[model samples]
Target: MNILLTGGTGYIGSHTAVVLAEAGHRPVLLDNLSNSSADVVDRLAQITGTRFPFIEGDIRDTALLRRVLADEGIGAVVHFAGLKAVGESVEQPLRYYDNNVGGTISLLQAMDETGVGTLVFSSSATVYGQPAYLPLDEVHPTGATNPYGRTKLHIEEMLAELAASGTNWRIACLRYFNPVGAHASGLIGEDPNGIPNNLMPYIARVAGGRLPFLNVFGDDYPTPDGTGVRDYIHVMDLAEGHRAALDFLAGSAGAGWHAFNLGTGCGYSVLDMVRAFEQASGRPVPYRIAPRRPGDVAACYAKADKAADQLAWRALRSLDDMCASTWHFQQRTAR
Candidate 1:
């Protein structure tokens, strides 16, 4: 099957492209290059030995999306194009809504018009907001406290309504936890355009000596380590989850919508990540206690039973592997 990946050059999207190609499917990439680089196309070819179709455009361009869908013979879409910073969303909610929400609306319209409805949405665990219980599951109540999570929630709601409307829409919303690590090849990895918003990347930069020291955010959260804790899944494992989701949608008997949490069912504190990276890189990752980031929760993890039972997918990489792979990429891409 030919699959179109919006924001395909981005971190997770690029990794998923590698997995899908290995699964005997063609991946057509579409990105605006806002948060990613076009050089990823070269790295992808080096990894996959296949120069996949790369389209430069915005997901909000309904006309462009329609043309690409028709011309590329796209059978499914993995939507990953959107602003995805929690802190930035807190400051600029309008931009998040307009880009994340508005772009999805346009993409859906084009897909509907073109008779393509198999969609695998890139949702986030942030949609669950502050967890009422540990190890959040699919049935957990969702009330996003930030604009980024709200955009994902709003998109999921729209997908649910569309699926219930009796159209042939087969959708899978994969709510991801923290996705870290790089490809084992150390060729293609999470190369953000600007200062990293995610913790793992920031920690990796500090370990790589690009950054002076890591800001240990809020060493006073109500956690074991007195800092924010999160479930960090390897990017490779998360990419496999995307492939599994696509396969689930294909083998399903009918059109419907479902959500699955893509995580390792484990939580690690900020201090834990810093220490782990230091161990992996054999570098002294100096840090200082900093103020808590806005829109951050004390602790959040996953109860990934649903995904395992339904899609036969589970995160197999360990934290050591995550940190080791990230350090490898940092070393290889050091400037």
Candidate 2:
């Protein structure tokens, strides 16, 4: 299957491309380099030993998407294009909506035009907001707390509505908790353009001496370590989750809008990650306690049974595995 991965050069999309290639499928990568680099294609060639089709464009370009879908013979789409920083999204809600929601709308339109309906959307556990429950399930009521999350929520709603309208749109929304780690080869990994928004990469940088120290936000949270705890799934595991979603959509039984939680069902605190990363990288990750950001939760995790049962997917990597792989990539790039 020639899968069209919008934002395919980005962190998650690039990882998913490798997983798809490992599964003996061709992955067509499309990105405008808004938040990622074209160098990922070269890295992917090194990882997979096969050069994939790389399209340098945005998903908002409906005509380009239509042509890509038709010309590339894209049987399915794994949409990952969007501005994903919560703080940035709070400052620029319109850009978030236009790029995340509007780009998806255009992509769907192109898919409709090209007669391609299978899709795997990159949803987030942030849609569950503050988590009324401990382990978030697919049935959790969605009320995103921020613009970045709201964009994901709005897209999920749109996909559900499209599926409900009898469009035969086979879609699976994988609500990822926190995607960390990198490929074992260290050829491709999460290296954001500027300051890292997520925790693991921040810790990696701090350990690597690129960043001075990590800001341990609010060491008074209600957790074992009194720090914010989150379900951190490995990037490879998250990538496999996308492949599982594609497999589900390809089946005759998968015909409607389905959603699953892609997580490890285990929450790790900020300090836990720091310690683990320090151990993995053999570097001290100095940190300072900072005030907790508003709207931050004490802990957030996922049930993950739905994806395990329905999609035949599970997060197999351990926290050590996550830290080790990330450090490997950091070492590879730092040189």
Candidate 3:
């Protein structure tokens, strides 16, 4: 299948591209390089030993999307282009809506115009804000507490509505948990532009001496270690989840929208992640306890049985592997 990956140069998108290529699928990458580096294309070639066709453009360009979908013979689209930071979204809600929600609208318009209906949207666990229960399921109640999550929820709702409008759309809304780790080759990883908003990258920087120490957000959460707990899926496993989703969409018996939780189905606390990173890097990830950040849930993970049963997919990597791969990539990029 010829797949068009929006934001394909970004961290997870790049990893998914390698998986698609190895699975004998052509992945046409479309990225604006706003939050990612152009060098990722070269790194992807180094990892896959094949150069993918890449377009340096945004998803908002409906004309560009239409042209790419037509010219590349795109069978489906894996949408990943968006603003993703929670805190930044709170500070810049308009930007988040414009990029994430608006971009999806534009992409959907292009797809409708071009007769391309299959889509695998990159949703987030944040859509299920403040978990109504442990191990969030696809049926879990969703209400975003921040603009970033709201943007994802809005897009999911939009897709649901689109599917109900009598269109032959096969859509998969994969709500991803915390995605960590890097490719085993250490060629590509989560390389944020500014101060890392995610935990793994911050821990990696602290272990690599780029940062002073990690601020353990609120050691008062009602978890085993009192810090927040989250389901941290390895990037490789997350990439495989995308493959499974695409396969599911391809084999769909009817036009419908499906939602799945892509996660390891286990929660790890912030302290556990720090210890794992420290063990992996053979260095201490110094930290200081700080007040809890607003909108942080005590624990958040996935009940991934739906995906396992439906898509025949489950996360297969360990926490140690996640830390080790991330540290390896951190070291490689630091050189």
Question: lDDT of all predictions, in order shown?
Answer: 0.93, 0.91, 0.92
lDDT of 3 by residue, 216-295 (tens): 88988778879999999999999999999999888845368989999998999999999888899999999999887766
For residues 35-71, could you state the per-residue lDDT of candidate 1 as single tens digits?
8888889889999999999999999999999999999
| Clash count per candidate | 0, 0, 0
Q: Which candidate ranks first by TM-score, i.e. highest? A: 1
Stretches of model 1 off by over 4 angstroms after superposition? none
- Badly placed stretches (over 4 Å) of model 3 are none
TM of each candidate vs. truth: 0.98, 0.97, 0.98
Candidate order by decreasing lDDT: 1, 3, 2
Highest lDDT model number: 1
Reference-based TM-score, model 1: 0.98
| Model 3, residue 166: C-alpha shift (Å) | 2.5
